[model samples]
Target chain A: MNTKPKILIVDDKPENLKALRKVLKDLDIELVEATSGNDALKATLCHDFVLALLDIQMPGMDGYELAGILREEEKTAHLPFIFISAVYTDNLNVFKGYENGAFSFITKPFQPEILINKVKFFIDKHQQEVALYELNEELKNANKELDAFTYSVSHDLRAPLRAVNGYAEMLNEDYGTHLDDEGKRLIENINYYAKKMGALIDDLLAFSRLGRKEIQVSEIDMNEMVEGVLIEMNKSITHNAKIKIGKLHQVNADYGLLHQVMFNLISNAIKYSSKKEHPIIEISSNEKNGKIVFSIKDNGAGFNMKYADKLFGVFQRLHSQEEFEGTGVGLAIVQRVISKHKGNVWAEGNINEGATFNFSLT
Target chain B: MDYEVEILIVEDNMSDAEMTIRALKKNNLTNKLLHLKDGAEALDFIFARENYSDRKIENIPKVILLDLKMPKVNGIQVLQELKSDERTKKIPVVILTSSKEDPDIQECYCLGANSYVVKPVQFEMFVKVVSELGLYWMILNQPPK
Candidate 1:
């Protein structure tokens, strides 16, 4: 039923065709034999074959003419062929066989094992190529689905969240004095939680966007980027945090993406250590193994080492939302941005001992 | 005499429109502000066509606050029509919506949007934003003759 592997062998002599058939009879393969080049071309149209064995010397239509015909047809253009001939085994003829797309050639007194091994190699290669093509099609479909998901998250989800926050604020601003203390507190909680959900949605959108966004690499000044981020953070974080900036080196990266990485790391450091009378955060960089490694060490609420692997995962939190106000997507975004830059990121921490986050770029 | 409509807010969400109007009222700017439900109504109001034929076409609003995603028509289409027409091209347009997608931002400006503001999730911040926008577009910015 055409399920079995097929091979075509063509020759002008009956004895030669018999020998070729006898050699391949042991294998579970269908063998089609042709006595002339025209007959070989006709046989190829009827059955799909893994390999073709062609005789260089033939009657009206020779092996080269048959191979050229098969190559012209779109269906058999990539069909593998091996030339077998007793008369045209000279250098010029053999070179012509190769130029016509013969994968390998077998002479009249060729070894049986040599013919079998060459056929097997082409069969395996064709199978691998088919599998790779299927995999690529699947990847393209998956990316299309991901794009749709990111759009829904960015537009559909945020629209309702904005309404919830907006109306609640309106209620509180217009009717706060009319309500009792408990009523006022309840409205405040509602607004706070709504804003929290909005923050989570924003983080999710950012994380998904990194999947499709292109990264533009440039030379970034580490010192200037860190200074700017710290200044921005200070406006929101009113803690007695003592930040120390060590000797930092310039890096080759996407400026905006790497800037987000620095912002996330330094913000985490400051947040986890806000309880201390004087929160100490240190930033440093060094050259290692032809790559620049930067580290941010903070004396804050550290985590257990057992869950270290979950640190970079989306929505993975080492501390409760109450202890640290974050959507847990900070580290996940940091990891994704660094990985897109072809870099590595990891962290080390211990409970109540503070945590150190490190990333490297080459 | 033709009525002067200083601010035109094109928003589909009722609560958002109410909140925006309240913020403008807090600054005593709601006296001449007009809120339409969607881009279609806003277009009708500005061009003095269909239901708005009684309104004078010369009395254009000082600024248009457009939202991107709407039911009948959208902000981009409205902006395109406004910027292409000679009578309405000189009026300023501000795109205010929840979408922060980069493509939307680029497209809005390409369609002649004067400014783009992503709505903040915090109510207090939203109130502050609306008030500032009203002040800037209604009082500060000058329109073409």
Candidate 2:
């Protein structure tokens, strides 16, 4: 449990301080007492307070004068203060109290219940503000740590991987003539696995970059974008596959990210369905609830609907490496990019029937 | 060989330096390639100062393949010093590093790097990249008189 909130009570007379302390004794608070304005300022120097109650008729420096001083310093500028006085109850004095950043005013011989309610309000508000400030600081530190981690992933991790791959390739090139068939095959396996690792690293880095890169939003023609991605990824699509692209609507999104989403989905459609003699992949879109729902359907080795929920996760794949080759980061990246545009990604499929990947832009 | 340096590679890691040199050698660029262990040595060789005073500054290499993270002085610092100096500013400096971090790329370009290439993790790709870059810099690119 949190400690009781601190309250500073300042008055010149011993009886006035004693009376204020006695009334507040019932409430859960740690109260500090001061006999003068100077003493109160010194007390503030050593401790933080949730509420400060000051008497208006103190010697040398009065309550309003002390509040003015607190307002000038950044440390105590926002400190909640309540001015108490018997003689200074006029309209001019009360207005002066507010001008010096007084939160509330309590006259001498004020009601015990009224003072308690006002004190409680300020204490709760101060605690809430402090908690919020701490939470904001934590979020900032987390973002900084992520940036550092990504930098290391890009540089430090890849360096050793390059060394491993490079040396293995060198060993194969230099000693292939002397090695037996089995020896050569083992080296080839090393090379293959190393290359796969390199691709995975590249995919992970690209995914991390999407989180940091600022999105540039603009109008994009989905049909034109798909046509362009198909041209770029022509080799990935098999010669026997038939691709049908239906009417696609224009959308407001980040052009580069939308292109990636299409690339990953279309390539996935072609790859999964490539085993069939006549592969059929259809791309279509429709408007629903003032948002565009784009879908890709392929007649290939479809996954079970039971694991559909895991389709968009990073490195999450339903198919084994023997059936299909992938780093499993494509769908994860697609999800992240679409979500960044205030959109959603989901899939539906059955065993050996086919799969349809759908996404919406809001 | 007329003591002319065609390609100056500044790399700190021993394995990377050897592989980079071997890649260039495979492309038949073995004759005039000079490999320095760190940025400080590269700077000294370029300015022909300290222990390198016997060498002529006017005979600067056609290209400098500089790695970013190094001891004594980093790649960005070397690029900055070279670009700011009138005597050595004309030589092309390629940033060959494992880091594809945005800030490093932006800073290297701002410091007057001629080209930036991330070191590929696959050995075959690394060899291909190094050989292509070597041929392009040593044979294709023209330096000022």
Query: Which numbered prediction scores highest in lDDT against the true structure?
Result: 2
Best by DockQ: 2
lDDT of 1 by residue, B49-131 (tens): 88888998887888888888998798889999989998898888999998888999999998889999988777788889999
> Residues A1-362, candidate 2, lDDT per residue (tens digit)?
27778899999999998999888888889999999989999999998888899899998998888999988978888898999898988889989999998989888768988998999899889789888988989987897688668656755777777888778778888987989999988888988887888888889889878878789999998899999999998855545679999989999999999999999999999899989888999999999999999999999999998898899898999988999999999999999999989999999988889899999996
Per-prediction DockQ scores?
A: 0.57, 0.69
Every model: iRMSD: 1.5, 1.1
lDDT of 1 by residue, A187-284 (tens): 88888888888888888888888777889999999999999999898897777889999989998899998999999999999899998777899999
Backbone clash total for model 1 is 0
Worst 10 residues of 2 chain A by lDDT: A147-156
Measured with C-alpha atoms, the lDDT of residue A120 in candidate 1 is 76
Off by over 4 Å in 1: A1-116, A221-224, A238-251, A277-279, A282-293, B1-4
- CA displacement after TM-score superposition, residue A320 of candidate 2 (Å): 1.4
**Candidate 2 accuracy as lDDT:** 0.89
The TM-score obtained for chain B by all candidates, in the order given, is 0.95, 0.96
